[model samples]
Target: MYQYDLIDKEFLADRSAEFRGQVARRLSGELTEDQFKPLRLMNGLYLQLHAYMLRVAIPYGSLNSTQARRLAQIARDFDKGYGHFTTRQNIQFNWIKLKDAPEILDKLAEVDLHAIQTSGNCIRNTTSDPYAGATAEEVDDPRVWSEVIRQWSTLHPEFSFLPRKFKIAITASAKDRTAAKVHDIGLMLRKGRDGTLGFEVIVGGGQGRTPYVGPTINEFLPTDRLLSYLEAVLRVYNRHGRRDNIYKARIKILVAALGAEEFARQVDEEWAKIDAARADLPTAELARIRAAFAKTPFETLPARSDAFETAKANDAAFARFVRNNVKPHKQPGYAIVEVSLKAQEQTPGDASAQQLEVVADLAERFSLNDLRVTHAQNLVLPHVKLDDLPTVFATLQASNLATPNIDLVSDIIACPGLDYCALANARAIPVAQDIARQFADLDRAEKVGELKIKISGCINACGHHHVAHIGILGVDKKGEEFYQLSLGGSGAEDASIGKILGPALPADKVATAVDQLVGAYLNVRNDGERFLDTYRRVGLEPFKEAVYAQAD
Candidate 1:
């Protein structure tokens, strides 16, 4: 985890102190609700349907035990006993009181975390591969680039109030775990022909009322020129992106209207002008940042140990966990363990205080004290020694956090739909729960394999239904919940938007409909083919025929 410097500490304290006064003025009736809206949003507070929701940023989803503990404290002291971990790798406390927000921000500041840049029309948290440092396939940790962008974008005077809120996600891995394609600006890190790691910049990708996969503005951007290139892209967007219609105000709309070729040209033209304005990116700066993320001292070990194997043999539950929750680590003797938030019949991504505390303890004991929250809404201990897997598995099993279903059908990504969100048309949680239950059997789920079953209550795609291998969007049909299905969509190296299957299915028949769809996929699929690959080969006609054929 990156430690906050003196400047960062002072910045938060100052920002909180200023916001405290702003809140006082608002609550004292000196500022009306209308007047307070933008200010509060700037501070990461949203007045949703029931109550105020406070979104706290977890930068690049990295945290220490202390920071994790503080979040547990906040959940216990202020709102409910739990908090929702979002797709953005941020945490949202749904039922927040107006007056206590500043105090919450103040508490967060103590741990060097704050909600600033979490909302408003500025660059949001720079997400990356959650498995960045742990993955063997990484070119470099994407958080290195993420932190660079974070420092560059925080309260940037020029781009503060753009036409729409901007998001940037980077990934160093070949597989895209961060959903980089759906961000306003997506940076894919790769080793270029010069043997130096650089970014493949994608622009105008967004998901809301209208979804779009960003086009490649630059195929290769040297690490040194990253900030300059980003500034050029933003400048182009700020000058010409829609201001006439708020709905179409995103850079995605602009890119769509301009066409990718024209958009790339405009960005290139803008780069020549603003590239000179950016300060020379110091090589020492990146090194200093990298040093902050240096690998902690690890105990030397011989080839693979027996504790993991012995546990797998002795305990079926632990075996399932090792299969689902544990991932290969970069270090010889270590592993990446997922503390699943997707337990059956429970709300997806909701971690109670006790669970958070247990995870923090396990992170310290087993993972050298680093905790990461995945974009998939799960807690990860990125450096667990293979020798300690049994103990960690047992402890997590006791808390019911050891469900070994990281990328399975049951490990669904969902948003706080009608239950907490003002924009939701129907409840997404219950539907997710139903889907999870429908595939609760471990063997059956494993057989289904590597499917991204995502749900959104409405068009915002907070649940990321737009990127699912099997996308399920909840819609309102005469006051009843109906689900619209889409297939062949992906958020990885080859990103493509999902195509809708057909008419929406009634809520009651949704799980069965999904079953039929999956069954159809299984029948036509090649040997060991994933859902999307099969869909691509056989096309949607098979899925459409299967889903509608059994419509009762």
Candidate 2:
């Protein structure tokens, strides 16, 4: 994890002080709600349906134990007893009081965390592979580049306010764990023909009402010219992107209008004008950032752990947990453990203050004081030793955090919809909870295997429903809530938008409709075919027929 320097500390302190004065003026009746809206939004505060919500950015989804502990403290002291981990790998406090917002920011700054650029039409958190440093499949740790982008983008004078909010995701691995293709700028670190690692830059990809899988603007860009190239891309968007209509303000919309070839050509033209040496990070500065994420010290041990194997053999629950939550790590005797926040009948992506504390403690004790928040709305202990599995599992089980359902049907990704958001048309959390309860049986859920069900409250696609294997978009039908179901979507290496099945079903029927779709998939699937594979092979007819037929 990157440590905050004096400059970072001083910048945060000044920002916090400025916000404190702003909040005081608002409270003193000098500023109306309308007058304070933009100011609050700039600090990642939103006025939701129920109360104020504050979003804290977790840059590249990286958190040290100290930072995690501060987040838990914020949850306990300022807002509700729990916080929601969002699809962007940030955390949101749904029940925040306006008066406490500045204080919370101050607290966050103490741990090198803040809510800046979490909202209001700027580059949000630069998300990356959660397993960045721990996975063997990666070319190099993506976080180093993510941090470089973060430093460059944070409060940049030229691109501070664009046509709309922008997102960027990077991945060093061949597998697309960060859903890079769905971002405005997706950078894949790969080897060029000369065998030197560089970025394959894709631009204009986004979800929301008008979804697009961003096109490859540059097939291979040298690592040294990353900032210069990004500057060119942003400059093009800033100059030509739509600003007249809020609906079509995204860079994706601009990209669509110009076409990928024209867009790339313009970017290249813009790139030619900029000084690459000045724009790109110096080699020494890059080395400083890279050194901050040095490999964790590990004891030499055998590849397999006898204690872990024995625990799995003796305890069925532990065995199931290992199968579901434990992921392969680069180190011989270490494992990457995913902590699923979506337990049966609970809201997905929410963790209580105590649960957060538990995770922080676990990370400090077993995982080199590091934790990662995933885009799937889960927390990861990135370097747990194989021998510590039983102890970690036991602690998680006690805290109701051991929900052996990673990538399973019950492991849903949903946004805080009508329950909190003012922009929501329907309640996404309840629908997710109901469906999760329906598949509460672990045996049945495991059989359903590797199914990603993403639900969005509206067309903004905050929940990333467009890329889910089973995507549910909640819509307003008359005065009631109806869900539009889509199938065969994926956010993986094979990225594709899902096709809608039929008419939107009422909220009550959504779970049953999902059940029908799953049943249809199970009936038609061949040997070792997952739901996505079956849906792709068979197309939408079978699932559509099954769902609508049952409705009729």
Candidate 3:
């Protein structure tokens, strides 16, 4: 994890002090709601359905034990006992009082964390693969580049009042776990043939009223020139993106209005002007940043742990944890353990204060003090030892944080829909809970194989519905909430938008429809094929027929 430097510490402390004053003014009515809204939002405070929601940034979703524990404290003292982990790899406190927000920011600052750029019209949190530094498949840790973007975009004078909110996601893994294709800008890190890591830049990718996959702007930008090229992209968007209509203001719409080739040319032309005037980032600065993120101490051990095997042999619970909670790590005898937030009947991503504290304590005790937040709305203990798996699982179970369904059906991704969000058309949390309950059988979920089910309250794609193997988008028809299903979508090495499954299903019929769809996939899939692959090979007709056949 990247530690804050002295300058960073001073900057955050100053910002926190400023925010505290702003909060006091708002409470005294010196700053009206109209005046304070933007300022509060800029600091990641939202007026939600029930109360204020304070979103805290977990830059590139990386955290150490101290940071995690601070989050636990915030949940305990300021808000309710739990926090919702958002799709942007950030955490949200849903019950924050307007008066207490500044105090919460103070606690966050104690751990070098703040809420800046988590929301409002400027560049938002930059998300990357949760496994960035540790993945065997990455060209480089995308966080290295993400940190650069964070520095450039935070409070950049020119971009603060852009036409609409902006989001950027970067990923280094070949599989695209971060869903880069649907972000405002997506950067895929890759090493050139000359063995230098740069990025394959994609622009205009976003989901909202309009959904778009980013078009490739540069095939192989030199590693050192990333910031320069990004500046070019932002400069173009900041200049030309619509301001007349708020609805039409996103960079995605602007890029689409101009063809991809022309957009690329515009960025290239901008880059040429800037690149000629500015020199490459100094070698020393790069080395300094790189040194800050250099790998944590990794101890070598046997390929597989005999103790882990013995535990698995004796205990079914440990066996389940080994099966689902664990991911292959780059270092021997180490495994990445996913702390599942999608426990049955709870909000999909809510982590109680006690649970958060448990994870923090476990990270400090058993795993390395490092933590990660996945784009799929779960936390990761990225450096857990195989020897400590049983103890960790037991501790997590006691905290109601242990559910051995990392990528399984119960591990759903859903937005804070109509329940809290002002823009949402329907409630997403209840639907997610219903589905989790519907597929409560663990063996049944596992037997069905890997399937990605994403839900959005509306077409904003906050839940990333467009890229799931089974995507559900809620819509309002004659004032009633209904769901439209899509089949064959994926957010991976082979990303594709899903096709709709004919007609919308009523709220009551949704889980049953999903059941039919999953049943159809399981019945027809050929050997060793996942849902997306099977759907791609066989098409939506099979699934659609199964889902709607009852009507006939």
lDDT (Cα, tens digit) per residue for candidate 2, span 434-454: 899888889998988889999
Please give, for residues 136-241, the per-residue lDDT of candidate 1 as tens digits: 8898988888888888889999989999889899999988989898889999998987799788999889877888988888888888888888888899899998
Error of 1 at 318 (Å): 1.9
- Which whole-number lDDT from 0 to 100 does residue 418 have in model 2? 88
Assess every candidate by TM-score: 0.98, 0.99, 0.97
Comparing 1 with 3 on lDDT, the higher-scoring candidate is: 1
Write down the lDDT of every candidate, Cα atoms only. 0.88, 0.93, 0.86
Residue 51 in model 1: shift from native, Å? 0.9
Off by over 4 Å in 2: none
Instruction: Report the poorest 10 consecutive residues by lDDT, candidate 3.
Output: 275-284
Tens-place lDDT digits, model 3, residues 366-388? 77788889989999888888888
Number of clashes found in candidate 1? 0
Q: How many collisions per candidate?
A: 0, 0, 0
